[model samples]
Target chain A: MAYNLWYWPGIQGRGEFVRLSMEAGGIEYRDCAREEGAHALIENMATFDRPPYAPPYLELDGHAIAQVANILLFLGDRDHLAPSNMNDRYWLHQVELTIADMVAEVHNVHHPVGSGAYYEDQKEEAARAAKQFREERMPKFLRHFEAAAKSNEGDWLIDHRWCYTDCSLFQLVEGLRYMFPKRMKTLEPDLPKLIGIHDAVAELPGIKAYLDSNRRLAFNEDGIFRHYPELDAA
Target chain B: MAYNLWYWPGIQGRGEFVRLSMEAGGIEYRDCAREEGAHALIENMATFDRPPYAPPYLELDGHAIAQVANILLFLGDRDHLAPSNMNDRYWLHQVELTIADMVAEVHNVHHPVGSGAYYEDQKEEAARAAKQFREERMPKFLRHFEAAAKSNEGDWLIDHRWCYTDCSLFQLVEGLRYMFPKRMKTLEPDLPKLIGIHDAVAELPGIKAYLDSNRRLAFNEDGIFRHYPELDAA
Candidate 1:
């Protein structure tokens, strides 16, 4: 049975994290929102009595799970992307949660005042936020990921195998590069392990196929990671 | 064995959410950072082979779990604070994750430009962010929680009995009130279910005792939710 994944059809956004993992795990899933349209996502969300606060919910076996980290946790165990040991699973989740935190910050950099206002209305605040994000926050978060990777003697964030965290890190790097090209270029040399993991994830058979196909959406201004050259720096 | 919870010493902050659950569930745990000092939190984080990106990590049996949502998920089953069914547990987690999202956004309101910079340095940006937060986000998040409560037949966010999500909703309401008193008072009438849950959690015997005791830290400027008169409005 295929899982039904619902998210905004136009942009990768948070949903791409789930898509990356499912693609890597070779899990059969339908990108319902993309196929049906944004109306479908809104209608699908309203159908649930306890509807999700936002999109990127996964429906399988008559149950819908929202929140990227929660959905990954539910799928990790089933798809064998997570460890058998409870401790290892929680630790992996910590890394994923931190990744989510960084992703939120990335979104905030482009919309510093709040998501309610247009980017143009908040450009002045976003510039200040963008400078701080490109200078301090980006490095701090990347260093945390680097330290997590170095903790184990393997290329993966946890255990000696690729898991959901690895897929997320891969998307994060790709998105950051697209969003902050100069900064990522300058920082990539220092993040060898992260770069290596990103390369390894790209080489995965299922992920490679997805990347080559139209299934993988290209980075755009509408997505979480937007490319505003003025918002990025070395 | 008592669990050791490491977090910032002076403020309730994110750790309070974990503290509230432990208090409500009558679980035994030590506030290690509070018992020691800020130095201990720094030292303890450094000692971990795979150190967490930030604090509020629960250490037991030599296993450390970080990230508020991950820690709650780890403890939920063992302490009987989570639903027994897998689907319900995931749903509860989704609510908790959404609560975490609101909490993070709350923090960003005060430190809109950067957490590294002093609030005074970014007060202009923060004022802008806080305006959007008060006018938009607070209602949006509160409505989400209120809707979740209404969807279920029980008073709690998910199950009939109090779960970790209920504990978190309690904290979210308390923090928002402390940080945005005027805004909350204006919004509370529309949020009957959320206010009801907050009052109910406060009346829980364990929570009531903890609230009366010195164990519960008072809200201050150092925490996620800060009271800034200039940043708040009705």
Candidate 2:
């Protein structure tokens, strides 16, 4: 059955993680917010019996599932985007949650004061956050992900098969590159496995098609990963 | 089965969330780090075949589960700390993940520049982050959780039964009170349901015993929620 995905229209944000997974799994779903405008998304959230704290919720068979990692867990199981083994599924989820943590950290680099404040307002704090993120946090997170990838026999995080976590890793690497080109360029040499996953996910026919199509939103200042040249480092 | 939990000693931090659930559920577990030391916690992490990105990891049977929400999902299901229904489990998990998000934000209030940087070094930035957290983020999160508690029939988050999410909510409120007593005093009236859950969870036989025992650590500056007078507003 087809599902409805709700998120802000103009920015990729966390919604892009869900979008990439659905696209890669060839799951049938409607990008409801993108089609109906972000106001519809806000209005739709009010109608949910179980409201999400934020956007990027997925409505499946009349139930709304929120939280990017939770939604991915549901879709991953239903669409075979996760491993069949139960333990492996938990392991995969553990990795996804860590990725989620890193993503949150990435967002905080640009909005260290709070999301309520504009980036321009917190530019000085953002610069400090960015330096710490680039110098210490990014490499630490990348190494953890690379180790996870290395744990399995193949390039994927689990059982040598591409999964929802792989799609998310692809998006994460892409976002990092967009947000900190100079930093990413410096770190890429050390993240061969992560970069490999990114390259492989890019070549997937569905993801390639989505990326080339107008449906894929460009990364901008409004999104979780914003590129301010001043925040970048080498 | 007895499980071993590895986390930093001398701080409640995120590990308290897991400890509360297990204690409330009467699940058998060892606080390995507290029994040993922080160095032991780090050393134990190295032994894991699939290492956790950070602490508060539970080692069960032969496998280790990391990520507080992931570990709670595992324990909550096995020990009836979550609803029996599948969809309700997802809803509970969604709330827990949101709680996790708020916890991260709580930590960031003091450590906005990076976890690597000291609060003293970032105190100026922390003041700004704390203002936004106390004024904007805390209320938004508390309201969402209060709404979740209200969505159910009782003081708990689901099916009129106490779950791991309830324990987490109790801890969240406790941490907030410690971090921002004046702010919580002002917001408490609007969070009747949330406060009710906190009071109810606090009164649980298991939780009360744990709180009275030496096993329960006091909230401190070292933990995720830090009390800084400069950060609090009424």
Candidate 3:
């Protein structure tokens, strides 16, 4: 069965989460919106069942699935992105959803006034958002990641088992490093366990291969998480 | 055993979504956060293998699950909140996640400046935020509902299945109507099937009783979705 992934082609956006999972699991899928063009992207959006309030939906068989975390869980379960043990599976999703929650906050650091507004227009608000995000949210998310690491009793979220939470944490650390280089540079030291998880995630065989290859999309301003110089503090 | 639902005590917020599912299913559970007091909510937040970034988590049989949609899906399947068929189950989650996306947007409407800021301070921004929400989001969401209605070969997203999607869609319409009355008044006429679904969900034995009961929290100014007079317009 061929899986069709539809997202704004230019930037990784939310599609990247599902992409990372599919790649890690070696699932074959097409980037539909990229192949079809922006017009097709908008047209497909109009056709979706709940109509994604935004981009990054996956089309399986004929049905389109939106919401990034939901897509990840769907693909994860299909290809073993989480633990099978009930508590472990539940914990894995909590951490993943928390990552999603953090991603939203990271996006808000530069887009506090609404996604429709440009960064330049909201820089003042973005500054305040970034400050709060950097000081409060970073530690909060990292603390959660650290707790999960401890709970797993080793490195990965499920001890010896690596799950989608790891891939997502890899993405979170990568995205945060891209968007807030100086901030992350200073903050990374405090969350040693989270950093260990992030570093370990990068070295995973499938992910290592994917990142080294052309499959990894470079973080750009066009995506949900973007780096703005004024918003980042050293 | 009994389910232990954890969430913030003061507001309907995200916790309400989990509560609705439990209530609709007629499942017995404790509002753990409420009974434990605000201090316990904070204490619980601090303790976890993977601590939730926010509340509205569920402790069922020693496993904790967070995220509004994930919680709904977990409960939906276990408690028959979803259909037994593979296709309908897939579609049901699609609808639930989409409702979650809409809920996120509704949250952005008020917190346009950022979650850290006081809404009073962001009223100017919230006005602009609410404008985009009313002009763009409400219709877009309504159209999605209309299509889902169209997809319903019979009534619900799946003809014979009254799943969590129906309950959530009912809540979305209800919340949207409460939060954006003037806009919904205009949009409702065009979304007949959605309204029908909303009415159908309202009449369900479980939901109908919940709506009339005191256990159902009233929508107030402090929730993720709110009704501010200045923020609403036709």
Best model number under DockQ? 2
The DockQ for candidate 3, computed on C-alphas, is 0.51
Docking class of 3: medium
Task: Give per-residue lDDT, candidate 3, residue A143.
Answer: 71
Write candidate 1's Cα lDDT for B1-234 as tens digits.
788999999899999999999999999999998899999888888777777999899977666789999999988977888877888888988999999999999999999988789999999899989999998898888888889889877777765688888889999989988999999889999988887788889989999999999998899998998999999899
Structure candidate 1, residue pairs in collision:
none
Instruction: Show model 2 residue runs off by greater than 4 Å.
Output: none
Best first by DockQ, ranked: 2, 1, 3
For model 1, the local distance difference test gives: 0.89
Winner of 1 and 3 under DockQ: 1
Query: Which scores better on TM-score, 1 or 3?
Result: 1
Tell me the lDDT of model 3 at A7: 83
Error of 1 at A197 (Å): 1.0
What ranking of all candidate models by TM-score puts the best one first? 2, 1, 3
Candidate 2, B188-210: lDDT as tens digits: 99999899999999999999999
Q: Considering the true interface contacts (CA pairs under 8 Å between chains A and B), give the fraction that model 3 also has.
A: 0.53
